[model samples]
Target: MAVPAPSAPAATASFTNAGPAGFWQRAAAWSLDAALVAPFAGWLAWPWIAAPAQAWLDQVRALLQHTGQTMGAAIIDGASLPRLAITLLHDPALHQATAAIRSATWAMVWPALLACALLGAIYHVAGECSPWQASPGKRLLGLHAADRRGRRLGTGRALARYSAGALSWATLNLGHLMATAAPEHLALHDRCSDTRVRAARTGLPRWARAWLVLLAIAGLVASAWLAQAAGTVMQAALERALFWPG
Candidate 1:
């Protein structure tokens, strides 16, 4: 009698050998990857961004001159500050300028945003499908993506996982937050792609932690500079609007 055929290996076994990565670990990896790609994407999109930005700045300058002239005359004629502010708010020219600037700014930036997104997608897909089964950032964090059987993903599967990440963003990042609550800390995209971000026994490297600290410090300094610049601009504009020769 012929022996029974060997049973096929179960494909549904969960790959739980390593613990799933936490949300903060995944976020840090993504931030590192974004920082790596941002410069190249900015360079590629500069041409599209520059011209419209210049045009918008020119329009803003013209509006500032017109506003100073209009408001200076009103102030000289003894108009109360409250009334002048109300009149300025109701000015058709001011409204037109606001709308024009908004449109121009959006036009100036969409190409750059698109370029960055495309580059990021390419970077993530290639890295995930590579032998390391992780991007440079993820590898730095000791993380890897694997299928249900803990196998490295093929190119197609990696691409699918990346594509499904759009859903995570589309949900306003609620899908990403799901990882905090889900069993094994699997994110929505991880579930959709039948993959998980697994952490190695090792923790984040010292260099990676230092990089994050420096990045935070730089961000804080930049924000402070921007705030000071904006305050100065407003002060200058107010002075011009109030004291311009009428």
Candidate 2:
């Protein structure tokens, strides 16, 4: 009786309170984030990305002029630029010239990639560590990220999460698919960082959610495609610049 009386207050059991986001929610959030930040990344990398391509185009133009290829020389002379481009695209000489350009440009890709990676890391880490506890995209979608104990991530943890997320995107996105297979819907990056994405209570209807997700995905894809197309056009323009000073 005395021992029992002396016993301290009973310890309270604790349980994990994380709300773990599902695949669709995470995908929607990522799509939104990419839409918002990818352009900035491309802009940051533009100078580095274009330099080698420009140089290669210039070299190709000079060679084409020297070799006396009618279409290539005309392309450089600003004579019916679009028509010449179409002709060159079918020209075997054009293929060889651009092949050299393509090879040279490959090495230059690293700078653009590095710039984009850095921007993306900062964007994700900053958003996750903020008081909002999510990127703007995730917040808009009523989702948040947290640790196993339902705590907001610290900056260090956020950085680690972003770094691991890069791996999740690599390897055919098998790491991301792990979320679908996990009991708690934890992705490989989340597991590696001991974090999870949680959905907050929201009043939006189902249709709105679907539309939002779709819009975000479409925007991200369109932005990426446009960036790539712009780069291609820039390289072609550099070739034309050799003939037309403008």
Candidate 3:
């Protein structure tokens, strides 16, 4: 009887030739991720933000009261735009008001901004390093981050990629725009980190397209509502300031 031939081990598959993701795809994914992360970041930063925000509001009210008293009810009630502008420009209190507003605004904003940045960094780094090789937003869009060999990124490489993304922002986003023209569709951070965002599919799925459309509609509606509400509030504040008892 003849001896059976030994079988060879199966070779592992290399990276697919799905190509690099388009700029719009990457942008959409980032936007989605930002939306998902913003609420949590805001919640975490609220404790630090609330006091400064309240202080800023108080300063604004005081400034308005001072302005009303200085300009007097006559000029304000008449709604003389030029006179109002001239008075505001020459008022010494305006300088102090402006300074206080700037200081309070910065104090209220910085903590929230820092929280968002830190949380975003952690989210991106961990997601890219995971077995899925993509953040939830990227995965939803059928995109993944990988090395040249199509291997998933390590934690260090993912972190490096996330950090280098700051360069893209610092460049006024010209670094990010490079993806549109680059032969391989690689952005500055992608090149700096030796990584790529690959599209697992040719185009967006129907569900993603629908979701984007709905999101756009919702955003438009929210913006319109906010603008109307803001206008109403400003009108009310102006009326109160002009008519308030001395």
lDDT scores in order:
0.80, 0.71, 0.80
Give the higher-TM-score candidate: 2 or 3.
3
The residue pairs that clash in candidate 3, if any, are none
List model 3 lDDT by residue over 116-228, tens digit each: 98999899988988777889999788788989878878889999999899899999999899888755789999999999998876666777677778789999999999767
lDDT of 3 at 120: 92
TM-score, per-candidate, Cα-based:
0.78, 0.59, 0.75
Give me candidate 1's TM-score against the actual structure.
Answer: 0.78
Q: Write the per-residue lDDT of candidate 2 for residues 1-246, one digit (tens) a residue.
A: 445532211210111333566777777677778777878877887887687778766755554553344544565656796776677668776677767767767756777778778988888888888766788878877777878876778899999998998788886899998877645888889889998887764234485478776787978999999767655655565555555544
Q: How close is each model in CA RMSD to the real structure?
A: 7.2, 10.1, 5.8
lDDT of 2: 0.71
**Local lDDT at 184 for model 1:** 85
What ordering of candidates by TM-score runs from best to worst? 1, 3, 2
Off by over 4 Å in 1: 1-16, 56-89, 202-206
Taking the tens digit of each residue's C-alpha lDDT, what string does model 1 give over 117-194?
A: 899889998888776778998887878888887887888999889889989999999989988874588888999999
Best by lDDT: 3
Q: List the residue pairs that clash in candidate 1.
A: none
